[model samples]
Target chain A: MIRVNNITKTFAEREIFSNVSFSIPDAKIYALVADNGVGKTTLLRTIANIYNADSGNVVSSAKVSYLPEERGLPLEQKVFDFLLFVAQLRGMRKKIAKTRITDLLKKYSLFEFADFYIGNLSKGMQQKIQFLSVIIDNPKVLILDEPFSGIDEKNKELFWEELLELKNNGASILISAHKTDDLTHFCDAFLLFDGKSIEMVDSLQLQVEQK
Target chain B: MINSIRIIWLVAKNEMKQMFRQRLFVFLLFILTICAISDPGKENLYFMFFVLNFSMALFRSIASEKESRLAEYYISIFSPTKLLLGKIKAYAIFFFVISLLINICAVAGLLRFVDVSFLPCVSMLCGWQVFVQLLGCVFYLSLVAFGASYSRVHTEMQGSIFVIAILMVSSYFVVENLADIFGNVLLCETLLKYIPFTMPFVKGVGILPMCVSFVAIIFILKFSGKIYKKRLFYYGKNKITEG
Candidate 1:
């Protein structure tokens, strides 16, 4: 479980959000819905500890894997090598990491592109590779920002399947998505961000309200 | 402790692979080899070339990582200190290998002029030269890492590289050529004596500059690690305010 206290963040005298607080329970997916510039990315970054909050703290004992909205992958790195590096950096042993990466690639049908440089892959393929890097180590807390932006519908279905499997196995997921319909069935709850703050709403309630 | 070392080793190995893949680096190595073999008499010029070549390599490696935002991934997994130390270790090894090769070329070139009887002394001198060069390269590369972290754009990063290179080269020239001018002034002479470049000329292996260089290396590494950590977390429009 992860608890975010009354976190406030501002950028260059502009307040992105204030007094935002929430908790992500284990074994469920929480969808973050907000319009552009509503601090969805910033909020996620704060939770991941990549960005510091001005006046709050995050409490979590679980190991975390964060996928930022902007991909920061090394373009020259081969897919297998890159995933191996990610796993190792996350504290996996080299032998285990190699096997885990190989299994992930095979499962995702990316085994063929293991030797190819990331820059040479298609956008969707690269997104899959990035996604694989995060999930390879089975992080306890998985935070994804716009995880489905570049992926195609077919891969999206596959991704949803994997995410559900992770959720079933008790991983806490916090994802930011603009498309509500796509995530209505997958998410257990929703955190709606206005220009000033965040509010939690049940996914079922959100669906009824949309109707 | 073991985990930290493993992290550093993995990062350093990957960085070395990336360095070897660059055509420009290969080309520069060729040029450095030629310069070392052809101009052994001008040891100062050769040393300057070594500094310039390694400085550029270090700067390019760091700047490219910054531009690509790739360091963010590593920063997310490990502490900024580990990341920076790993990079320093990688470049230190690179500098050591290249310095060794260049020293061999210089010794071979010098052999053509001197009698073979002086081979043992020449080898010892070459070893000392390589050690001093390694220390200088590590110090300069740490400075490069610090400077590169402040750059948010390619143009600014390029400008910083030139500034650092010029600063290093100019300081070496002033110290080597204008020693007499400084010698007359007590304060200037005192400051000049601490400069690491002048240490090589001092008889019996200048211990003072080596000590100064070692301290400077530690100071810069720690300072740069803090800056890098701050930059990684406090980016995107907000100036990092001191706590």
Candidate 2:
């Protein structure tokens, strides 16, 4: 479980958020819905502890991972070389991580492109590899900021399946986006920001539970 | 320890791939080789130095991603320290190989055509060039990595580190190369051994500075990690963590 209490952040003179607070229960998929430039990325960064909040406390386990809203791949790095590196940084051995990379590359349907550099691949392919860089480690607190933004419908379906698998295994997901309908299937509840504060749609029923 | 090694290893491997495989890395190698071989006599060292600084700047651009907003994705999974090690290690290798290449070309050209036995000198000179350039590269790499880590702009890493290169080179020469006294006379040569940077040159390509260099690397390894954790400055602004 992740508990965020009274968090606030500002950029220069602009206030991004003010004492916003919420809790993400274990095994729950919380979609952070808001229009653009409302500090969606900032909030996700704060949650990932990549950005320190001006006020409030964020409590969570150490087993957390974040997928930034922007592209982070080293364009010259081959797909397999990159993800194995991420796994290593998070405490996996090189040999062990390389073995895992083989499994993940195939699973992501990237087996053919495993040796190909990211710059040579399409955006969605790179994005999927970027996602694989995080998910290969099996983070308990899975934070993805606008991961679906640039992906096509077919690729999004592939991502949805991988994410749903994580959710079923008791992962807590924090996803921020402008589109609500595309994510209605897996989101257990919704968190909305109206540019001032954050409010959770606590009573919304999950598709499975409602059925 | 193992995890950090793995990350750093991958970082070095990736950088080597970029330096060797891509059309750009190959183009750079060709340009640098032309510069190294085409120059006449000891003047080649001057061209090699230009190539040295050029390669350093190039690697800086490649290594700057770890410092920018682009770093946000990777930094979440890897600690700032591990990330720093990876980048530092990668760029160091880039500088190392290219500088070694320069040293070899210079020595071989001096020995083959001029008959100075660069092969006899390669062991001593390679040792000196590798360790010295490696040290210089890490110092620059750390500064760039820190700037990139703290900046929203990825390209800022290149600018920030490069702008300080003149100062860095000045310091490196004044402190490190000053010791040899450029192989001068007896009275001065005796005293040169006592000056830290000057004294290492008396060892004449021994492990003297190499040992000290390792200590400095460890110091950077330990200090930068603490700086990021206690001070959340990676957001392009400083925010102290208050309990």
Candidate 3:
């Protein structure tokens, strides 16, 4: 489980969010919804420890996998090498990392381009690679920021399936996306960030309200 | 500890692979090696050039990571200390191997072309100079890396790189004319020899200054890590950590 307790973040005296508190239990997926600059990405980063919360803490019992919103993978690195490097940094042994990366690539139909430079791939292909890197180590908790930004409908379906698999495997996932309609279909609940605080609502409740 | 070492080694290996993949970088390394043997008398100038070039590399690496937001992702995986030390370790190995090769080639060129009789004296002097200069390279590189942490983009690194380049060049000139600059003050000369920037060039000093350089390197690297951690996620003057 991942628990964010009373987190606050401000930039240059401008308060983005304050005392934001929420939790994601095991084997569930939650969507973070907010308008642009409303601290959706910032909240995700704080949980991932990429950015420290101003007045609170995020507590996770195990390794947390994070996929930043942007295309931050090293362009010069080959896909396999980049994944291996990240896995090792996350404390995975080389043999296991290699095995898992291969399996993931094959599953994603990216094994043919395993040795290709990441910069050479199309935008959607690169997004797939980035997502593969995120799930390579079987993380216990995941914090993904706008992971569906640059992909097509078919790839989006693939991602949803993968996320469902991860959730069913007892992983806690917190994902932020602009499309609440897509998230309502599978996400267990929603954490709506409205600039000052967060309100947790059940996914069924969201669908009902939308109807 | 072993895990940390493994992580550092992985980072270093990755960096080495990335650098070697660049044909221009490889060509430059070749040119540098050739230059070392062709002009043994200008080894001091070569050392300065090496510092300048590698400092640029460090600046570019750090700046580009910040610009591309890759540093943010890296920070989440490992401590900034590990990332920075891994980077420093990669360049240290590169500098050590290349400089050792250059020293060997310069000595070989001297024996074959200049004078065989000068072997004993030249060997001892070159040996000590190489050791001292290696320490100097790490020291300066750490300083540059620390300064590079302040930059948010590649272009923003110009101010720090300029200042560091000037410091490195001035240190070279200062070492070249030590006697003229100090003018017979033994205590002053001894003190100057311990300053991390010039310590690499001042020979004949004992192990004490070497230890001092080690301390300086450790201190600089630790401070650099702290700065990097602070700057990595910072958006502006608000100081995100303090928000």
Winner by DockQ? 3
lDDT for model 3? 0.82
> What lDDT tens digits, residue by residue, belong to model 1 across residues B17-129?
87778888878877876776666655556666766776677677766666566666566677666777787788788767867877788788778899999999998988887
List of chain B TM-scores, one per candidate: 0.83, 0.63, 0.88
lDDT of 3 by residue, B75-166 (tens): 87887778878887888888888888878877887786667788988887777778888888888888888888765545557788888889
True contacts kept of each: 0.26, 0.50, 0.54
The candidate 3 chain B region of ten consecutive residues with least summed lDDT is B234-243
lDDT of 2 by residue, B101-139 (tens): 766676766666654554776657655755654664565
- Selected candidate, larger lDDT, 2 vs 3: 3
TM-score of chain A of 2: 0.92
| DockQ, every prediction | 0.36, 0.33, 0.49
Say which candidate scores most in lDDT. Answer: 3
Task: Give the alpha carbon lDDT tens digit for every residue of A85-151 in model 2.
Answer: 6787677777988988899888778999998978899877888887888788777888888888768
Clashing pairs in 2: B67-B148, B67-B149, B179-B198
Task: Quote the lDDT for B94 in model 3.
Answer: 84
> Which parts of model 3 are misplaced by more than 4 Å?
B106-128, B233-243
Off by over 4 Å in 1: B41-43, B104-126, B178-180, B184-190, B196-208, B229-243
lDDT of 3 by residue, A1-211 (tens): 9988998887768887889888899999999988898888877877887766778998897878888886577898899999999888888888999999998899888999999999999888889988887887888898888888867999999998998998999999999976588889889999887889788899999899999
